[model samples]
Target: MQGIIHLWSLDATEPHELTTETLGQAQILGCGSVLHLLRTLSWVRTKQNRIAESSTKLWLVSRNAVGLERMQAQSPDSSRQDSSTRDSLAIAQAPLWGLGKVIALEHAELWGGMIDNPEVADVLVEIGAAIVSGEKEDQVAYRDGQRYVARLVKSDPLAFDGTSLSTENSYLITGGLGTLGLKVARWMIDQGVRYLVLTGRGVPSIEAQRRLDQLEEAGATIMVANADVSDGARMTRLFQEIEEKMPSLRGVIHAAGVLDKEILTKQDWGRFRRAIAAKVEGSWHLHTLTRAMPLDFFVCFSSTASLLGGLRLGSDAAAFMDTLAHLRHFMGLPGSSIDWTMWADDGMSLPSQEDGKFEDNDWGGSDKLAEYTMAPGIGLRILGTLMRKADTAADAVQVVVLPKDLSYLQGFYGDRIPPPLLSELYRSESVQPSGSSDFMEELEKIPVEKKRDHLATHIQSQLNRVLGFAPSQTMDLQKGFFDLGMDSLMAVEIKNRLQTSLGCKLPTTLAFKYSTPSLLIDYIATQILALESPEGIVTESKRAANEPEEILNKVKRLSEEDLEALIDEKVRF
Candidate 1:
């Protein structure tokens, strides 16, 4: 009744009641189902906490390849549920490693690891022996014999061959009404794709319709389908309709997805479900329906968030795409998950400026690093290149297109960046400031009173570069940042510049707190003077050492009335 159940032997007997003793005795608890895996993992975590000395191994064996590396490296076009569900499940599984690590650290006798084996029963004994003997070195083990490792290798720029695409072949593009989708559609037409089926949940916007009309006028047939990709039945029917009308469904660009900005803690199940439906469920539906069809390419439009996990960003959505990539590899499908960085014109790249132009939000506002924003043309070209390479590169499941310039990322990642990436980053020429270190030193050496004006000028110059403003564009010193056309993105860039140049740990809200250029300049000067001044009343160095203790002792000795008067004087300063 306490023995482990083989996945294939689910119907062999009635469900056995598992006790803590039984669970502890069992070296490996294998679960084929993700649900069962999660349940077992939770139970193990509880048991580990409850019984400090318990050693248990939870083996999560799946027929499909599932891991961070597999998910990150491969592009897969599985059922939409597979992508979203698997991704959510994968993320949910991440805590198991943490639990295992903690258990290992706290109790040397405790051992646990996740193993991915298609035939769980075949390796159950071997895995169990390994677990019992404490032979496994890593927390996660793969039974498939394939290793997933990321290597930074320079990909040669691909030439755009217009002759490759055929007019008789039709291509399906989900989210075609959106800016990026529309751009891709237009680019496809230019590349000799005469028939294009663009699908979205609603009617195209007036602007999108106008663009579609222009494409139609250019002699390309554009069919806009008002259908949701998450609806499997609707997708099936839509594909049937396309098969009937179109000459041939040659390719598909799965670009449909919803952007949910809520952080994981703030996000509800509904929000996560809705955000993932378009990318995960939709892609799954497309893959299921189009598996029989002979297609040249099937591209999943994924974001770099899949790897980076941006602040309050789409972690769930990224995981779905990563899982989709792994699923595609498992299925031996012809597709690549392009983990793309930010694009300047479309998507959630940057907020639009007052003149309707998009500002660069790359490098998180640091000019010291290389900008990572890709133009629409450049993005399209990369996509084209990836599609062409997909045929020859069977092992290449994931294609990450990063900015050639990566010096800026060093500021954020520092030594944590992988050596492979570092090698590639140093291989290319990085952007350097025109201003010399000697010039900056000379500016810093100016009289404290004069330093404020010099710092303001320097700050203004840096702001102008980021905002794409000319040297002659005079900024109002009294105006707030918002009034001066400075947004959150711009504010961040300004803060980064100040932190880097002045060597001060400025607050993220520095721009908003100061409000104006003159105020910010004054604040910076005060901080710089406090840092540099040796004879100042309350220098940072003194404050760090014994100022707090001294202040507390002085406060304790003062009377109520005297304390109030002392606080007033301190506030005045």
Candidate 2:
């Protein structure tokens, strides 16, 4: 690029084309650019920085006229590195996790989907600063056999300078390739971490490679290994391998977890006990494995289940929760003889089929449940803060993260779910179904035919029963959608049963609403016809509302995606 290109003025009707001499004529727009910069920053990073007691999102962007004009007058190539931060004091913190908004200089909404991973957050911050100073950043590499190109857009100074944390030593992630694991993996890079050891199950995909590339380009070298943290022998072997490759290891991030669908009665006694094995027992494995190794902090991702004494459905996990509570009580553990950890779930609330169920602004009368759900989350957070300061606390530090309503309570925290705010989808009603239906009963009704017409008739019958209306071969779609009250939750349930009985890939939304049996049957017929091999619906796990096999598979696959993807992969059975 020859000399330079500049044109901007919020006060003018059109962008002002200013040269070095006339640039001074431009009017200063108090917070226009500031707000825009903050929004953009939320898209890529979130500032953990605080100013005068406000947690703001920060970005380092190109300098402004006030600073740039002053610098150029001194030197032609003159520019200054700047810090940009936004305080999202008002927006729902949980939803806008990594975004900031500019209403007044008071606060910003840290976009949630964006900064789920710390690495992405860190890089965005650095980029924001570079842009503010009018400097070009080096090419950042990306995965998927390509590179992600980023540019420095012109912007003014941010009110608060972002904080810089030291990332000198190597870190170990127990569930290194799990959902949170992958995200935290790259986040380490953003904070100036140098090397990474990725441990998880499965072969790396294009996106996974791209992440490694991006992190590496951002100066974070990564290594990939597939191992189950629950297997101490394999874990020991992995550490030995890591020792041979990249020796400097300092921290451990334990974000692995196991979720159950029913109360203890619903599952085999031994089968349900595995939750403890994977979560709590796994933590012990990591603690003992690296006990003598040189390490700093051990961050374990405990669930809100422990704090809430576990839930009705997940109460069996109490033993695991107890393990965390007694991590310090257990001996032979490394780093102060106990694990310093962070217990995290979604937020103060739990993500359920009901999180989005409030039809009226009065919060839909679920405040009590929401309060109960969020309590453990707050406790987890407090524990985390204490755990980080473990040396000053009792023996170890512990923090917690609970779930919250993105649509309602994100403002209370410092995160936003990001828009396209709430997936403004206009789905066909034939796709929607009742979410909380009896799972086994639905499967029992499937006809013993291996064709679309058979499945179509089956759906027609079910629709007639549910809505108390029969239909012809074809019916109006609105009958299934609007009048019937179908939603995302119902859609999931319907689809699961449909796939099992119909032996086809049913649109997940079909169960939400069919207005009329006729319309829903029409949709099922189409999908049934596409099946390669439709099987008779013989659902298992009768005692428990176990996750649909397909859904579980999807979850397993999701544990391999990036951090943000991990956050998005969240679902409550």
Best model number under lDDT: 1
After superposition on all CA atoms, how large is the RMSD of candidate 1? 13.7
On residues 171-283, what C-alpha lDDT tens digit does candidate 1 reach at each position? 99888877778888899888888999998888887778899999999999988898888787889899889989888897888877765433222334455456555765666
Task: Identify the runs in model 2 with alpha carbons over 4 angstroms from their true place.
Answer: 1-168, 309-322, 329-388, 402-573
Evaluated against the true structure, the overall lDDT of model 1 is 0.54
lDDT of 1 at 455: 64
Tens-place lDDT per residue, model 2, 319-421, is 2333332333233232221111222333212211111122221111233234334343343333334334433333343333323322322221112121221
RMSD of each: 13.7, 27.9
Give the clash total for candidate 2: 76
C-alpha lDDT of all candidate models, in order? 0.54, 0.37
